[model samples]
Target: MVDELQDSVPLLVFLGVLSASYVDHVALRRHRRQILHLQVLEYYTRPGDLILFNGRAKVSALQRSLTRAEWDHVAIVVPSRDGGHLQLLEVTGDGVTLSPLTSRLLAYSTFHVRYFALRKLRTPLLSRAVVNDLLERFTAEVEGLSYGLSLRRLLHARQTEPALSRDSTFFCSELVAHAYKALGLISSSSEANDFWPGSFSPGDFVDAELGRHGASLSPEIIIDCKLLEVATATKRSPST
Candidate 1:
């Protein structure tokens, strides 16, 4: 059975891609609730939260299909350093950027914006000093880092739960994994974390399997996955 399933992986991936490609054609078909549900979410979420995104773009839809995951993108919530509001740190095609979460909602018209998981730690994996250290390191060195361009590496990876890598270059999941390893959130050896990047995709973080009682990672790391909207389906925009 295992062998048969392995052989079917390719067929499954193809079906996923084929299914996701139609998103753009029926983008307007999505039904949205009339009342905007923003104030509560904004008031509830604070800095250091993680957001798993189901982008409204054809590329995002394609990835969602490919990974068979509800979310295709992940970003870290960052409090504005200069004050006033919150922002997100993520590597899009434009590379790692700091932007307001509120602006993100306003920028898009698609209903996909409503589909995001506002994840946070049940208990902080690291101290404030450690968290600051990691943030500082990324800030100092994240410049010129580019979004990883290939899904092939993730697809062809060894059948390991937490895939590993050692490259300085960045992909969205790799970047988040790096943070997980650095803050001692993952149980593998620090050495192992270095090579653990490409093995796991974003879905692995939120997968049902990983939340088993004795699983290495914590379940509370994911706080809430609310599907709210910046705008209703009446307007369609796009994702990464």
Candidate 2:
């Protein structure tokens, strides 16, 4: 019996070590996946790319409820010259403006943003120079434009109808549509209000919404960034 017990001791220790090794391997792989997912935005974004948001604010909730869409906001990516960071062209309540990607991400905790790339064929439509020129001209022309927000407009959007005419003010999705139009990606006859935030999302629903305006803007999503909490934790981590 003593000899049998001594033989079992080595087997038990080996089994325990083997189980621990497997657990550690699994944890390391999980950690790697989290890091890769977080770095996706840096790896995949390009000029004219898009970032769509599912927001948690009351206004955002209202927009999503009315549109029956998951995303309630969108921004166009503008790559920096130094290739060190990215900027976003968007229309806020403050009107048309440029904001840093990191700052925007840090500011909005209750939003999940996804990266979308323009179709390869459509990417050739606007050169970098043209994109810059159009943004500059558009920004200057609509410097102090108000964000299109009112009960009337909200009701109109619920109907999914385009505004009768383009106005001096612009809304979030409207601004993106205008940019697409100027880039020759969408029809010239299309008005800005023809687009709502949901129009950019991928689905038969978005296809029908944009089709109603006689234009199309489809971008493929590269990353959903659902691991936003992982990013937040990294931010909270002490610097090395």
Candidate 3:
């Protein structure tokens, strides 16, 4: 009986080690799978993709907002903008960069103001006094009223029925137009009117064109935008 018990002890020890080894292997695989999942998701980002986010939220807030699927695919970078903020960076499989916001505050303000105003005053009834006041304010805020007017027209096009037009080509073309206007590359509003179409499709790959062109680049980049969603559930408490 003693010899039998001694023989069984070695077998138990060997079984214990095998179980531990198996658990470790499983855990390692799960970890690796998660890492690979992230890689696969971020594989779709492209260069010059306009990344946008409010520069006032916590980095974690941004992270939580993202789907696990998007989170896995893109790289995340916190931008050191004036306010406490973080920016997401997505690296494409082909090594491109993209972001949500492509223009500065002045450009955005012009676009938004014109867009909102047009929506507010779509009818043919034009109150000259009101129109003059709006134009004055717009002129004071924006350097180029003509460009703002042109961009406003584009915004109108975007707002029209079958919104976004038949083709998404307008989206990229308008973006490039705004960027050039913001940079002062084109002198007159008419010159800026010339559209340069770009192929920017979601899930499409983009390379870091800005970097190649010697544009200022951010060091850290992330794959997806994270936004927060709160969920509430009612449940009965367990009785003691």
Cα lDDT, all candidates: 0.48, 0.55, 0.26
The lowest-lDDT stretch of 10 consecutive residues in candidate 3 is: 114-123
Better of 1 and 2 by TM-score: 2
What are the clash counts of all predictions, listed in order?
12, 0, 28
What would the TM-score be for candidate 1 when compared with the true structure?
0.56
- Which candidate has the highest lDDT of all? 2
In candidate 2, what are the lDDT values of residues 1-240, reduced to their tens digit? Answer: 542432242453454311112112321333211111323354334555566666656877787898787677877766554545777778887877777765665455434332322221124445556766665565455545667667777766443535423356777887777766655666665566757777776663445534554444444432323355565664456779
Task: Give TM per candidate.
Answer: 0.56, 0.61, 0.21
lDDT of 3 by residue, 1-240 (tens): 532432242453454311112112321333211011112222222222233222222432333243121211222221223322222333222222233322222233332211100000111233323433433332233222121223454333433222222232223233333332233222333332333221111221111332233332221222111110111235669999
Model 1 per-residue lDDT tens digits across residues 88-133: 6777788767777766744532455535445543323345445556
Candidate 2 lDDT for residue 151:
76
Over 4 Å off, model 2: 1-40, 79-84, 110-122, 136-144, 157-167, 204-240
Cα error of candidate 1 at position 148, Å: 1.3
The TM-score of candidate 2 is 0.61
